[model samples]
Target: MRTRFPIAICFVFGIFTLLQYFSKHPTLTAMYAEILDWMQIVFVFTLLVGVISIFKIHSAKISRQERDWPYSILTILGIVVMAVLGFGYGTEYGSPFLWIFQNIQVPMQSTMFALIAFFVASAAYRGFRFRNKEAAVLLITAIIVMLGRVPLGHQISDLIPQTAQWIIDNPSTAAKRGILIGIGLGSITTALRVILGIERSYLGGRS
Candidate 1:
C-alpha cells in the first residue's frame, strides 16, 4: 500500500502535467497555477527541514568532539550570519546582505574558479603529453584551438583561426548534437521507468 499509493499519485500528477503541454482550457490552466503555488509552499517547508537537518548533524559532531569540529562551527556561523543579514537588512541593493554577498561570496567564487582553471590546465598538460597517436592529435587540436582564439595565433597565420573556426562549426557541433540526442534518449527511458513504477529506488525501499 505504501508504494502503491505514492505510485498512483505520481502517475496521476504526471499525466496531468503531461497533458498541460497541450491543454488550453481555462480550468486546466487555473489548476496548473494552483499546483505551482502548492509546489512553492512545499519547497519552503523542505528548505526549512534541510536547514534543521544540517544544524542537527553539525551540532552533534561538535558536541561529540569529532574530527574537524572547528569547521562545523564555521559552517553554523556562516549560515546564521547569512540568514540574519538576509532577514534583517533585506537583499536589496545597498543592503548588508548584498554587501556581504558581493564582498565575500563573489570573491570566494572567483577564487574557486581561478583554482579550477589552474587544475584544468594541469590536467590538460598531463593529458596532452605524447603517449599515443590519439593524444598527439588531441594535443595538436588543443594547441590550434587555443592559439586560433588568441592574437598570437592570428599573427602567426590567418589560416589557423579559420581552420579552428571550421573545426568548431563542423566536427564539434556534430559531436555536441550526437551527445544531446543520446542524453534525450536516456532521459526519456528514465522518465518512462519512473512513470511506470519500474524505478522504485526513489521510493526509498519502502516497497
Candidate 2:
C-alpha cells in the first residue's frame, strides 16, 4: 500500500504534467499554475527536511567522537548561525547575513575553485599525455584552445586564434549538440518510465 500510493500519485501527476504541455485549455493552464505554486511549497518543506537530515547526521558524528568530528561542530554552527542571521536580521543589502555571504562565503567559494583548478590542470596533464591518436588530437585541440585565449598565441601566429575559433564553432558545437540530444532522449525515456511506474527505485527498497 505504501509503495502503491506513491506510484499512483506519481502516475497521475506525471500524466497531467505531460498532457499540460500540449494543452491550451484554460482549466489545464490554471491547474498547471497551481501545481507550480504547490511545487514551491513542497520545495520549502524539502529544504527543511534536508537541513534536519544534515543536523542529525552531523550531531551523530559529533556524539560518536568520530574522526574529524570537530568539523561537524563547525558545520552545525555555520548552519545555525547563518539561519539565525538570515531569519532574524533579514538578508537585506546592509544585513550581517549579506555581509557574511559577500565576504566569507564568496571568498571561501573562490578559494575552493582556485584549489580545484590546480587539480583540473593536473588531471589534464595526465589525460593529455600522447597515448593514442585520439589522445594526441584532444591534447592538440586543448592546447590550441588554451593558447588562443591568451596574448601569447597571437604573438606566436596570426592564425592561431582563427583556427581555435573555427574548431570551437564547428567540431565542439557539433559534439555538444550531439551530447545534448542524447541526454534529452535519455531524460524522455526516464520520465516515461517513471510516469508508467516502471521505474520504482525512487520509492526506495527493492523494486
Candidate 3:
C-alpha cells in the first residue's frame, strides 16, 4: 500500500494540476496553492522512505560480506562520520569529516569530471578521420564550437561567435522544441497510465 500510494497521489495531483493550469476561478487558484503545500509535506515523507531504503540495501550488502565489502564499510563509516560531525561533534570546518569532504570528495569529483576531457579528445580524434561529408561537417563544427569560447580562439578568429550563434539559434532551438514536445507527451501518457491503474510496477512486485 505504501509503495502504490505515491503513484495514486501522483495521478490525483497530476489531473488536478492540469485542471489548475487551465482554471480561471480564484477558488481553484487557492486550491492549487494549498495542494502544492500538502505535496511538499508528502514529498518530505517520501524522501525519508528513500533514505531508509538506501540504508537497508547497504546494510544487507555489508551483512552478506559482498564483493565490495570494503567500499560499503567506507560508505557506512563516511555517513556516520558526517552525521557525527554535523549533529554530534558539531562542524568545526577544520574537523576531519568536513576537511575530507572539502579536500577529498570535492577534488575527487572535480578530477573525475576533468577525466572526461580525455574521452572527448579521443572521440574527436577518431571522428576527425571520418570520410562521410555529414560526419566531417559535424566534426568540424564541434572543433569550431570548442574553440569559439576560449581566449586563444578569440585571438585566432573572429567568425566563431557568429557561427556558434547561428547553430544555437537555428538547430538548437528546433531540437529543443522537438524534445520538449516529446517530454510533454511522455509525461501525459505516464500520468494517464497511473490514473487508470495500468502501471502498478511502482507498487513493487508480489511479496
lDDT of 2 by residue, 44-149 (tens): 9999999999999999999999999999999999999999999999999999999999999999999998998899989998999999999999999999988898
Clashing residue pairs in candidate 2 are none
Q: Model 3 has how many clashing residue pairs?
A: 0
* TM-score, per-candidate, Cα-based: 0.90, 0.89, 0.68
Off by over 4 Å in 2: 205-207
Q: Show where candidate 1 strays beyond 4 Å.
A: none
82-141: candidate 3 lDDT, tens digit per residue = 877788655676777678789888998999999999998898788787689988888777
Worst 10 residues of 2 by lDDT: 198-207
Candidate 1 residue 199 C-alpha distance from true site, Å: 1.7
Please provide the root mean square deviation of candidate 2 (C-alpha atoms, Å). 1.9
A best-first ranking of the candidates according to their lDDT comes to 2, 1, 3
Candidate 1 residue 171 Cα shift, in angstroms, is 1.1
**RMSD to the hidden true structure, all candidates:** 2.0, 1.9, 4.4
Error of 1 at 81 (Å): 2.6
Most lDDT-accurate candidate: 2
The 0-to-1 C-alpha lDDT of every candidate, in the order given, reads 0.91, 0.94, 0.80
lDDT of 3 at 131: 83
